[model samples]
Target: GAALAERVAAAGGVIGRDDLAAPTAEWAEPVRQDGIWVTPAPTRGPALLAALAGERVLVGGPTGEGTSVVAAADGEGNAVVMVHSNSHPQFGSGLVAEPYDLVLSNRAGRGFHPDPGHPDGPAPGRRPPTTLHAWALDTRGTGRPDLFGATPGGEQQVPWNAQVLGDLMTTGPDDLGAILTRPRWSLQDGARVPVEASASAVRPAHVLLRVTGTGLTAAADPRIGAVALGV
Candidate 1:
């Protein structure tokens, strides 16, 4: 967490954990708006995007190797999407428990601001601003998830996921395959918007699943050789 970095900064760039202990975490609720739910403020991608969209401003944005996303739907019209990440490569935080090797999330380390007073700043047990997020939508007023999806692209996660959700809402589920497999662009570093190579972008994969009157439809990005299969 930032405490280690803070201590090091206070010590004028020394490396040691003399008295600091590993960070801790607890359960929290998701943030919901309209019919969509997000991963909450500390994971500020959704909100940040909203701010940008509100002003219609231009700006940008990780590697997705340490992250993965999955979506599922059942017979009861229930659907879910999950985006999991280690915050960084190699199990993150590197704070594995002695026996079980339970790894703690490094969201505070990579997601937190350095300033003490910033909303996303580091504090003991404070959840930092993470880019990891997804969108869940229930368009039918069923109070249950009717459509869910997410993508893995680290800093690009927000734009990627947001674009897919936008397309989903606008075009519905029939075009899932084309929507994800189409050439995509990401605003990198808030300076340049670069489009991925057609049929060659390697960091590829996204899942969109929607429940319709007939059944559940799922689409998988094919740029990285992803395929739709029954399980």
Candidate 2:
């Protein structure tokens, strides 16, 4: 693959060096809100979910966004959910970042509010608020989380996760597949403080969900890729 990638690069192809190296980065601190762990600002996911959970938080306006969400769990009650995104409207910034060759997100310019007074205001070295976020739930009163998942529906990420989680907790895990397969709704702009009117807009935002029961049980939107791959 390395030789092929070198040949491709030499031939003016887009494929660069295949980097199988371990991903390394300075750990960003996490914040807790209403007992849920959130990827802190300038990603607005935590604030959005908190607002939905009836917290007084400030989450600036929405903007175009894109992302990929992945989650996995083990029998020992360990789980992880990850979400990655570019700014919006396809390849963000149109600039390939180093190492990963990622299309750097134009988050600061596009997602952050222009006004400096805003909580989500952008500045040098500051990331803009993003809709990319993962959510988890522990309904069994155990110290570990039994249910968790994420999605890439722009502002719809939180709403979908919240709705599904509510059902999963209320109706029990037996109906989980049915709850996920059922048509879901997304709030308008993913309102910072959702109201009755915000529920006006509704649609099936194709999202993959990973649930850990006896082992790992994955439920994905039928309108999308294979569930086994969690695409």
Candidate 3:
């Protein structure tokens, strides 16, 4: 709210607390390509869209890095696309629920800056950065739809989703299970995880492989114990 107040005061706009309290959600028309329809969840959608649109580019596969999925289907002549993610890493490790097999991790409590001028700085109930996302796509005039989601820390998800989508479209994989299983990720600092089949794949320098996909395919980071399945 302080950000809004600062902006309003700077622009001489008549904004008040009531205006901020009554904010409403907005839904724009779905984005489509060919017979495919896509929609992204809030926040992370724009970045994912940019990656898919070529405004941004990524040159690897999605593994321990973060990622989102887009599903497409047709219906009588309409297409649809959807994207979503938490956009942050798991900050809490103890909050687990077995009934639904859910882990109640704190997502929106990251990316905080200690600067008092920032909006997320030292707030009483501020949410942290989230890393979980859901992305979907549907084709025009069709009933079937494809959905994708992932849990990797921020920024990483964008490229992760793009790579998976490319695999689905260009290579025609039956499911993302295989791709996800053997996925690899590179950090912003140029350190890659789950080392690929290169000399650098072996480790002691970086994180070691936690889970292995199929032969020379993919693997999860052992640190996280994430799993992938193929049929």
Candidate 4:
């Protein structure tokens, strides 16, 4: 899949095709149980497909699942982390060579093959099936943290990190940046659903919230600009 369309054009999102355009075998076939070839994700143009074919329609494409996350909480509480390498260029069947192979470039993300009876398939050394989810909610655990978050959009990052932690746990802690700048929803894999023009009606997925205190206020998803920093 051209490394999932160059990791969704290097994470700036939007994969309307033409990464160099060359695959024309009906969108690269050959899945014969597991011969692996896969490719068929590209759309959302042509005037939104002529206004979604004026009726009955279903669409899907744009799945790169790349990642990069950071969550920390100190002063003796504990919670520091780093997560990288995900559904990006994931050098699996891609080429890699020349002077001992220099690093950087999908850095080693996608790799796993052993499907025996499919149960997340692949075995023998199993490790493929990672959406790289991050979460935090020690509300009752006593750690005091209530709603932490993470997102990069791959499998829509766990329903957009559980719908922004259920709207910051039912909109508490005073606005918390207006419940992460409001308007959000996501659920895809069928029946098509997309909403985020500052989301007011339709709904599906997109998130990045933080509800701690003292010095970590955050909110991201300004229809993609995603920004919010308060120190």
Q: Largest lDDT belongs to which candidate? A: 1
Q: Cα RMSDs of all predictions?
A: 5.8, 7.2, 12.0, 17.9
List per-prediction Cα lDDT, in the order shown: 0.63, 0.56, 0.41, 0.42
Clashes within 3 Å, all models in order:
1, 0, 57, 5
Candidate 2 TM-score to native: 0.66
Q: lDDT per residue, candidate 1, 1-231, as tens digits?
A: 355545445646543454245544667676676667777755644563474355443322134346677877788777777777776663765555434446655645777667889766677656566666777776677786667777766666666666676766677666778888766666555543545632313255788788877788888987665566667
> Which scores greater on lDDT, model 1 or model 3?
1
Model 3: lowest-lDDT 10 consecutive positions: 203-212
Give lDDT: candidate 3, residue 1.
Answer: 59
TM-score of each: 0.71, 0.66, 0.44, 0.27
Model 4 residue runs over 4 Å out of place are: 1-68, 76-86, 92-103, 106-148, 169-186, 189-231
lDDT-sorted candidate list, best first: 1, 2, 4, 3
lDDT per residue for candidate 2 within 113-223, as digits (tens), equals 778887667555565666666665555666445566666666666666677666765687654567767655545543443332344332333333334455556665553
Which prediction has more favorable lDDT, 3 or 4?
Answer: 4
Model 2 stretches with alpha carbons more than 4 Å out: 1-36, 55-65, 74-77, 97-101, 189-213, 223-226, 229-231
Candidate 4, 1-231: lDDT as tens digits: 455555555656444356336434443221111111111122112212222224323322224534555555454344443444434544322443334452334322233324467544545434344544444444333445454555555444444545555555556545656655566555544432444532223222233333444444444555545454433
TM-score of model number 1: 0.71
